[model samples]
Target: MSEISILKDFQKRQMLFMELYKKAFPAVARYISRKGGNYEEAKDIFQDALVIYYEKLISKSFSPINNEKAYILGIAKHLWIRKLGSNVINDTIESAESEAVFAEEHLRTDKLIYLLETAGKKCMDILRAFYYEKASITEIAQQFGYSGTRSATVQKYKCIEKIRETVKEKSLAYEDFIE
Candidate 1:
């Protein structure tokens, strides 16, 4: 195909993907909630499944052998099951179907964390100070010995932007957890 055709096709596929997500999201949410999971858990699982789907597509390792909905639902199912098996989640409310979704999401979260950590020490420190420590820009600047608070804030934003770009370039989604 020509470049323009490929681009158009890609856009079409993305739109289709979004439609599938819209349709599947409610079912996935109900499945999780019915199995004792909360709305938050459902959202987390769905987002992670989408990330996995994105990664697979970008890597060209995904096959359209099945419908997109089924493919994503399958990934979510696998995620839920792994979560149950790991004991991170109690199995009391878990159904066989729900387990797979939780498990796959758990794995995806782990993978995203790993990727964030591997971004580099500076990026990690900036993220931790801004996010985990909840420090003010001035305080962070003083601690890190930057020129001033403004510089510190700018640097922090830049670092996060870098991380975001890096994650995207690698076919990963960093926005959901990054802040």
Candidate 2:
């Protein structure tokens, strides 16, 4: 894509996101609040769901849907359930309960890593180079053949966003994985 087209696409996505935030956030917020989640948690889950929804919208595999708001809310509901489980949310849980939560989250992380490796090997390599190898931006740019540090930085952020979309897709793909 040309720079101009990329800019236009970004603008379009920004408008769509703003519209979704206005039309769908209130319903999702209320649902999360009723389920014992706070404002920040609701916001986080809603954003995650929105990213997933957007990915599905752009993909050719997505079928026609009547209600975009409902779809986004459904995704948010699943994310919340996966994060906190189906039972009641409690602030003062025992050590065992905390450990269980930790283990579940760890498993999710492992799954995400596996998916990244299989589905986005190049992105995984870029991320590992920047993060795990402690490579400098200039080094990354030279290795990846990016124009410069600025380009490398932008690519790094793009890879992160791609991973986010992948993770969201996985959460939706396996009913037992989340919820």
Candidate 3:
């Protein structure tokens, strides 16, 4: 491409990015805000999401997306979730105003674990191995004598689902009992 054409293309992309920022950022900001993230974090995630969107746009497999705003918002949401998974809990702990909340959270976590135990030792073991031990599916399969990784993966999902159900069932009962 000629230098003038290249400059024009860059200008076009710059305008497109600016437009995307104006059109898509509010929804992303609101989502991150509702999830307890600050404005700065929302901006950071949105910027990162824009970078990802641009990369995807330029890739060989790129397909024209009909809703750029939704695409960018979805990317921002995933990035925020990943950020939460990595550091939000530690941040929350460090910034907590009172130890009471922390202690209560600890107690609730312990109770959940105890409830999981009551559900079944095998399910608890499966969860502990995968999450706490960070065991790979193959390792879990080998250790548990599953037929294959797929079976181990299915079992792990079932264990997680069971935990969710246990928590949902117990949360109301536990809160009532505590009060």
If candidate 1 were superposed on the true structure by all CA atoms, what would the RMSD be?
A: 14.5
Number of backbone collisions per candidate, in order? 17, 0, 0
Residue 144 in candidate 1 has what lDDT?
83
lDDT by residue (148-173, candidate 1, tens digit) is: 98999888888878777777777754
The total of clashing pairs for model 1 equals: 17
Q: Could you give candidate 3's per-residue lDDT for residues 1-179 as a string of tens digits?
A: 53234324744654566567656666666667667887678778988988798778776687877667777777777788788775333333222223323323333444544767765878876775664345799989998999999999999898878767876876645333121
Candidate maximizing lDDT: 3
Ranked by TM-score, top first: 2, 3, 1
Tell me the TM-score of model 2: 0.45
Candidate 2 pairs with clashing backbones: none
Which sections of candidate 1 miss by over 4 Å? Answer: 1-14, 86-179
Badly placed stretches (over 4 Å) of model 2 are 1-8, 87-179
Runs of candidate 3 with Cα error greater than 4 angstroms are: 1-8, 86-179
How accurate locally is residue 50 in candidate 2, as Cα lDDT from 0 to 100?
81
Better of 2 and 3 by lDDT: 3
